[model samples]
Target: MDPAAGLTDVRAASPTTGDDLVTLDGVAKTYTTATGTTQALSPTSLAIRRGEFLSVVGPSGCGKSTLLTMISGLVPPTAGEVRIDGELVDRPYRHCGIAFQTSVLLEWRSVLDNVLLQFEMRGIDPAPHRDKAVALLDSLGLEGSSRLYPRELSGGMKQRVSIARALIHDPSLLLMDEPFSAVDALTRDQLSMDLQQVCMDRGRDLTVLFITHHIEEAVFLGDRVLVMTPRPGRIAEVIDIDLPRPRRLEDAGREKQAAYAAHIRETFSRVGVYRRNQHEGGQA
Candidate 1:
């Protein structure tokens, strides 16, 4: 069967709140690299409902990151348009938060201070969110380390701090590019669970567009998984995760997750697409 045929209209499967929170209509992206012009994303369309955790996966350099940046308004599309909540997106929106493969904490700053950096950058007062930030850290099992510098923390702790920072502003949309890629397997699992809980607790619907190379992780976390093709990428398929909600890592239902993951791997193989750096082992 055609992979595209496998996709169900995401909205049809789940009732959305009013209008879509994010819409990509015939969007495309091109880059003028040293090697010359490169088309990263082909014309594509997608709609993200409010409070949904959506993951995009494809062969590396297939504009996965480009798509993330385009939605975040960090990079302009070469063609077509991007809109958030019916408003055209021409620049980064204040109601957004982002985290990447690395923790990206300021090396000189203490963990608590780094967590507060986002508020300072936006010129927003951190006092109101300070308790929330502290609570986030404590829940992540990093309460005392808040006073320590990023350099003094372990890789997992640093990522925990990064996650805390991203949530400080209460962004309605979170764009994450492999945020847990640097941590160990155990820590990564813990972070995934923690993130789900965080989203559940927050109001105003946290719409997340997460990019990853790990099929299993994508299946495990995303409400819908958008798989993409190779260079000049186009969305290949959108797989709905029908597993029962509130999933934990060690649940017996994990076997079902493995089966869904197998479907992704098989689908990728059928399309002759693979991750850019297999050795990296981390998601995009």
Candidate 2:
């Protein structure tokens, strides 16, 4: 069976309901560098429905990361409003969870302790949420390593712990920025499967906004793929992943998966955005 079989089951059981959770209205972000003000993202609008897994993909420096940071309220947009469930997200919110490329776990904390750190910082009692933390670790296959430090775990394991921490708060929205990029191919697949089940088990009803450069990974996890253009990024296209839910790794869904990736690659090529980094000798 494909490692992602569990996510499919979750998708099947959770009949999609509810209204939009995150809505971006004419949102634009600009950075003022020494070189003068640069527009990272043009005015754009989009909505993320509750329980939807939305992935944003673009060529390097297309501002996919910028969009995520705005959603997380890390950076305020130069223009436009970012709303969560109709409330303007002008500052950090306690009901949100975030994870990124690095696990960002405290080196001094044990895996379980790291997962509980959020609660401690928020002045929440760890005792009450301890079981939830343990269960999250076990669900992600990190049960035996609860006492291990960040350095003691593998790249994939570290990422898993980060995920557990994000979900530990039981937040309504999950923001992930290239969370799986640091892991190997095999481990990435495994972790992706684990995430599918995690979201399903809680019926997280999460509005997940993920940033990824990998087309395949985006295709595998997202219900819709938002493609962007080069710097001064704007939404070039939004492609629906028509592949049926409950996708498997083998022939169960490979052909459809490949087609979606190919289509995205072709679109990138058409916009002259794919090979920009190789030619420019820089990371976008």
Candidate 3:
């Protein structure tokens, strides 16, 4: 099944909001190694409307993670600037929440306490946020596991807890970096569905920047998917997913899903960043 077969290309028009929630102006990054300096990202510009779900996919070492760090203000960009709600992001911004590939839960903390850790870090009273934490856990299907330790949970449960923790603070922007890549395939699928629901439920208020290596995942979850080139990474394409909202994996036939995946795969191939043999036969 050639997924790209019979698919038409669609591009998203830039939104004309009075103020974009997030903006990257000619952002670029360079790293100084012991031997020499290496350029990681080329000058790239982007604007994210409030409450939009944007997925970014690219080959390894393409500065996908670096883009997230700059947006979160955890790391400074070598050039250009990242702004959230029109304010320059020069340090760790309290308006953003982040989750990485690993669950990174505190083994000693109960699930509820783990979710409340964000409050602790912000010097806010956890008491005020306890109900919200419990609600978030319940929403993610972790209702009864609040009292359980991280070690007692399955891989999927731990990731759910991580997500709950990230959302407990009610951040305006959520940055997720390959959050489901470490879980089993079945669990990954389930997590994908759950996260999709979360985005739909909160899409009117929360903006998400999701980074993943899986083309299918990116296509399934993004309103617009941004594809980057290999090393010295820059945006190669920004594909608007024209599918209906509240999408299910089974909603679009394999062909449609394959089409989306195939388009991204083709883009990578054109840049000499992807090889056909890297993926399994008949798998997106």
Could you say which candidate leads in lDDT? Answer: 3
At residue 136, candidate 3 shows an lDDT of: 91
- lDDT winner, 1 or 2: 1
The estimated TM-scores of all candidates read 0.88, 0.88, 0.91
lDDT of 3 at 200: 89
Reference-based lDDT, each prediction: 0.81, 0.80, 0.86
Per-residue lDDT over 89-119 for candidate 1, one digit per residue giving the tens place of the 0 to 100 score: 9988778889999988999888888888888
Clashes of each: 1, 1, 1
lDDT for 196 in candidate 2 is: 67
Residue-wise C-alpha lDDT for candidate 3, range 1-284, written one tens digit per residue:
33343322212223436657888888899999999999999877888878888999998999999999999999999999988988999999888789999999999999999999999988988988788888899999898889999999998999999999999888899999999999998898889889999988996689999999988999899988888889998887777787887888875447666688888888787766856574557444
Between the candidate structures 2 and 3, which one is better when assessed by TM-score?
3
Candidate 2 Cα outliers beyond 4 Å, as residue runs: 1-18, 251-253, 276-284
Error of 2 at 85 (Å): 0.4
Off by over 4 Å in 3: 1-19, 275-284
